[model samples]
Target: MDTVLTTRHLTKDFGRLRAVDDLSFEVKRGQVFGLLGPNGSGKTTTLGMLMGVVNPTVGEFSWFGEIPNHHVRKKIGAVLEHPIFYPYLTGQKNLELNAMIKQCPEENIPGVLELVELADRRNDKYKTYSLGMKQRLAIASALLNEPTVLILDEPTNGLDPMGIAEIRELIKKIAANGKTIILASHLLDEVQKVCSHFAILKKGRLVHVGPVDDVGKGAETVEVKADLPDFTEVLMQFPGTASILPENGVFLVTLREDFHSKDLNAFLIERGVVANHLVTKRKSLEKVFLEILSEPR
Candidate 1:
């Protein structure tokens, strides 16, 4: 696949603090890539550097295989943190300003508004719009130039559940149309649902990077439930146990590593135990996020 964005040992420092340290990753064309981490994990700083809003202290990065510069930036659209607009201006007027700055055709204003589901509210002043509406308008402004890549920082923040869903669906639709998307968000579930690839950051450093599926590939836990009354005894026999949680009259066991279900079942049978339920649990993005965050920096 073609590379849309590439970072090589990118670093940024401020006084005694390192905001982004030695971060390196690649975003493929037509792929939805997520930059995930908790608050103060440098997600926004990375995006700012990528968009040229904040200059890197060291290392380098490129867009479309070329060094990121004003010329290259034209091919990228971005929303860093909150969407900034003139509160007194109408949505249409705000987009018109963006179009002017981007040198795009004025006709693009309505098209982008409609694309973000803000066409009906185009004439409304920016201050009158809800948080969700403001977010969609920010997205519309980003789309004004029809850039090949769209970068968003916490795009769903402060929105209600329904608003988050709307933005998620909109992002999916944007990706479906063959544009690459770079999403910076702490919402692990949202990233899992919307992104195909992701990188986990911690304390200004990149700790994990890969396809979303592979990030948590071996993190799944096995759930075992038996008719035996001594569930604690069964757990004691298993070595390398990570955790055990009881739910719905069953014990959910999280193992340190992968294990065969057949072997587990056989062990229970040999102990004169009859298992009514035995299954491997799927690892969620939330699990992966937490694990990454818990790792020592």
Candidate 2:
């Protein structure tokens, strides 16, 4: 399927509070999609509705262009929160039990274990496994069915640096293998690092949606410092120079629409004004997110 999932004006309400408001987006096949929002922004609630655990108060959604139901859910594997397993059971034993419950073949066990890099520790007790290993085991359980799409809600939540790194690499590995992934995270850096496309939600409302690489496009400000005596005058005369301000002996130039840092540099050179320093400062995802949230809805 070209489209893995689609939500149409999906919304949820708990009494008077709207958990998710008019949410609509599409996840394409083979794309690592990220649902980004802060705590209490209805990310978990949205996932719950999509997974059939919580019913939506308004709107609808579909999986593979079919109505979502148990059968459709079977094609999608997910880990919504912390994973649970028998602490006393060995990793191998836990997966074996999971496979039995999932009705998947026992032969799928070894391959999933190897995929998560937990093969060597398969014999270790679940309680003895480190947090990262436990998380990986949880992901392995989700993958036991060989699902078409995998949904992870804060897969790296509460993880230390090492544990987060482990999950990060594992996610990249999974996405590389042609699985459509829907990842919900509050960590901006992680989303920027792994998600090919993303939707930003604030106060349960989708504020922005686009490819991750397009985050700071057309929003960059260039900082220029020239050795010439008329540096400020030269900068102001350049085409597309929207505004220029002196900051600590450097000029911060905001470019107009359709203008960029390269154009500015070329203009300076043509005018016989050589710059000693020029740096284009792109807005980070975090900065862009805050700006999005602060805008009027």
Model 1 misplaced stretches (Cα beyond 4 Å)? 230-248, 254-279
| Model 2 bad stretches (over 4 Å) | 228-230, 245-249
Candidate 2 versus the native: TM-score?
Answer: 0.89
Q: Which 10-residue window in model 1 sums to the lowest lDDT?
A: 255-264
How far residue 58's Cα lies from its native spot in candidate 1, in Å, is: 1.4
lDDT tens digits, residues 24-124, model 1?
89898998999988899899999999889898999999888886788787778899999999999999998888888888899888788878888898999
lDDT, candidates in the order shown: 0.87, 0.90
Query: Clashes in each model (backbone N, CA, C under 3 Å)?
Result: 0, 0
Q: Number of the top candidate by TM-score? A: 2
Model 1 deviation from the true structure expressed as Cα RMSD, one decimal place:
2.9
Error of 1 at 52 (Å): 1.2
TM-score of each: 0.87, 0.89
lDDT of 1 at 11: 94
